[model samples]
Target: MLRTTIMGLCLAAALASPAAAHFQELLPSADVLPEGGTVDLDLVFTHPMDRGPHMQMEKPLRFGMLREGQTTDLLPKLVETVNGGKTAWRTSIDLKEPGTAIFFVEPKPYWEPAEGKYIIHYTKVVVDSFSTGEGWDEMVGLPVEIRPLTRPSGLWTGNLFTGVVTKGGQPVPYAEVEIEFVNDGSVTAPNDAFITQVLKADANGTFSYAMPRAGWWGFAALTEAETTMKSPEGKDVPVEAGALIWVKATDMGKAP
Candidate 1:
């Protein structure tokens, strides 16, 4: 009887533990469009480090692009798609001029039963068209955002990406930031702890991480919202607001 009781306690403990981190991915087909053309983007919410167990993302609250100080609504162009057997979104935009295009999405609040909270991630990605090299650091004016200090596009492997965490245009001191790489089944983690890399921003709300691999990396600055949301059970739960940015790193190699 004692052994069975102990087994029950262990199972409860495991269920109570925190689940893997969920990252909202806004991945573009190419970070740099040498010649102006249409670039496709994939919007998926999942544990990018594990590359599975995707969460269904409802239609976003807002989706748009910023180019040359003008914001264009792209929500009408979003097409429903499936990823990892879950609902996702996809859209494409044509760059007609040489400049930087910042695509951003504000997803609907997702209710997590385990955590007992609603999650809303404001995610964005930068695509440089014709290498304009300007407007890479522009802000999308999200409630919580990461203003990139380093150029967001055309990065080489091992480049240190830096950004400042902000809420309502003001810096968030010592914010918690989570980093994860988009796994393509080429690398494996030794343990669960190695799956998600975490760090804290300094007093100025600035943090940096060097990309170790040549692939897409996502940085999420997580914080609580000022208000709560009603969960499906009709209970008011806290809101977890995440400001995420995706960047691509390329390895130095000769072109074929």
Candidate 2:
């Protein structure tokens, strides 16, 4: 009887604790940059839907934009910023061309004690300048990446977003993807499960999810890294390599 009661209590305690989903956010001031204008970006490692317990981020290993089959280094523009007492990064870039610019960041491996592993989310976001909208489908060739089957820009609510998960330029069969919205603090989840929706890729490594409402939705595909890293406690731990992409959806119309 005592053992049964103890087990029940433990289960209840675990359920009572909120599960925070980690997301690497690369948010631009606007998804479509106007000609002769600058687009600002905020790079943070946090639980977007939960509004944080923002994690401290070290300097990114790589930060740049890929356009027209060329990559431009943007690391020189990053400036350290603080939010909720945690370190983050901010940068602004001038958009002069009429083509699509895909900005990406390879952050330093973050040690997550709660998960017992290090996490490195290779995050990317697309910005269309001057309405050219070209080159949105090009892959930046990260270790793990999501190649969007959809255009990834100017999406409407209820539109199905599809993408293929890839590692080392090869498709990953039945890859697991986690989807979450950048909650504006107005949206609340009824339970923890609703915070992050899970989906699996098809045999071709393609997964699809429709944005239920208009907002920024993030899709993260996690895979085991080929290498391990030393933890803060001097122990070697497995690495969680994540390929993350973000897109914005707009409402079709208002109610009558």
Among these predictions, the greatest lDDT belongs to 1
lDDT of 2 by residue, 1-256 (tens): 9999999999899877866779999988877765637889999999888888799999999999999999999999999999768999999998887899999999999998877899999999999988677899999999999999998887888999999999999999999999989988889999888988999999999999999988889999999999999999999899999999999887877320
Evaluated against the true structure, the overall lDDT of model 2 is: 0.91
**What's the TM-score of each model vs. the native?**
0.95, 0.92
lDDT of each: 0.94, 0.91
Candidate 1 local Cα displacement, residue 55, angstroms: 0.4
Give the distance in Å from residue 167's predicted Cα in candidate 2 to where it truly belongs.
Answer: 0.2
Off by over 4 Å in 2: 1-18, 34-36, 253-256
For model 2, what is the error of residue 171's alpha carbon versus the real structure, in angstroms, after optimal superposition?
Answer: 0.6
Candidate 1 displacement at residue 238 in angstroms: 0.5
C-alpha RMSD between model 1 and the true structure: 2.0
State the weakest 10-residue window (summed lDDT) of model 2: 247-256
